[model samples]
Target: MVTSNDLLIKQRSVIKFLAAEGCSAANIHAKMKTVYGEMCISDCAVRKWVRIFKGEDPREIILRDRKRSGSPLSALVTAHQEKVDCMIRANRRVKQKEIANAVGISKERVHHIITTVLGYLKVSARWVPRQLTVEMKAQRKDMCTQLLELSTVCPRMY
Candidate 1:
């Protein structure tokens, strides 16, 4: 249902006319239909290909892409990945939330960069309670073990 010739001749003709007459792309499209028997040219089509021609920086028509606004934060996000890795290397006790706060990004992003980019396996840390009663601490730890066991049993229960 598709073929390359749909684009090939139209592109060449647009470029050729743009180079020859110093005409606005709009005028060229009109002239093509009126003077050259090309009946299908539309204003929007001319606008689209004019961009391609401009992007090529033709020796004749020098067009530039419209300036894009508000670039993605990924471009400016400093790869504190090395810093996070250093922190992980120096002290396995630091929390990912703290690392994210220090790096000015989301905690999930910090976790992702550390685990995915740095190739560091997720680390397990011991949790200690200072003010909890013995019974409360035992209850909390029991709940955690139960959750982990349930995950293993069904792999999706928790």
Candidate 2:
């Protein structure tokens, strides 16, 4: 299938060629579609480009073609959010691999939907352990004792 990028590039080239020949936008789109196949270009897209290129104070050519949104859902995602929810609710401790197997999707995809789509999961942050030397531990203990003593108040008699 022709991608939007490819279509845009081809459209620009066709517009430049048609403009040189004094062809109107509608005519240019029809001409290109007829010759280059409808998959490559559309009449409305061509018309929009012509309006921008020829109109006074030419606006940026905004192609109003519907852009594809989001990656195509795999079989796993196709199983429906409800199904995933049901599975998760039934077996909260189900491993990702087992879920993927049950849903016919990759473990990575299973994890992605669990964390991203469901929005009920957290990724653990990488942890770095601190190593305290014996001297440092002793100093910390002494500081705590001194701070506690300093904060203590004595009872007073009338």
Alpha-carbon TM-score of each model against the true structure: 0.38, 0.36
What's model 1's TM-score?
Answer: 0.38
Q: Write the per-residue lDDT of candidate 2 for residues 72-147, one digit (tens) a residue.
A: 7663454565566567768666677777788777787776777767654532531111346589899999998877
Model 2: how far residue 94 lies from native, Å: 0.7
Tell me the whole-model lDDT of each prediction, alpha carbons only: 0.64, 0.67
What RMSD does each model have against the real structure? 12.6, 14.8
Q: What RMSD value applies to candidate 2?
A: 14.8
Q: After superposition, how far is residue 70 of candidate 1 from its true place, in Å?
A: 3.6
Error of 2 at 112 (Å): 1.4
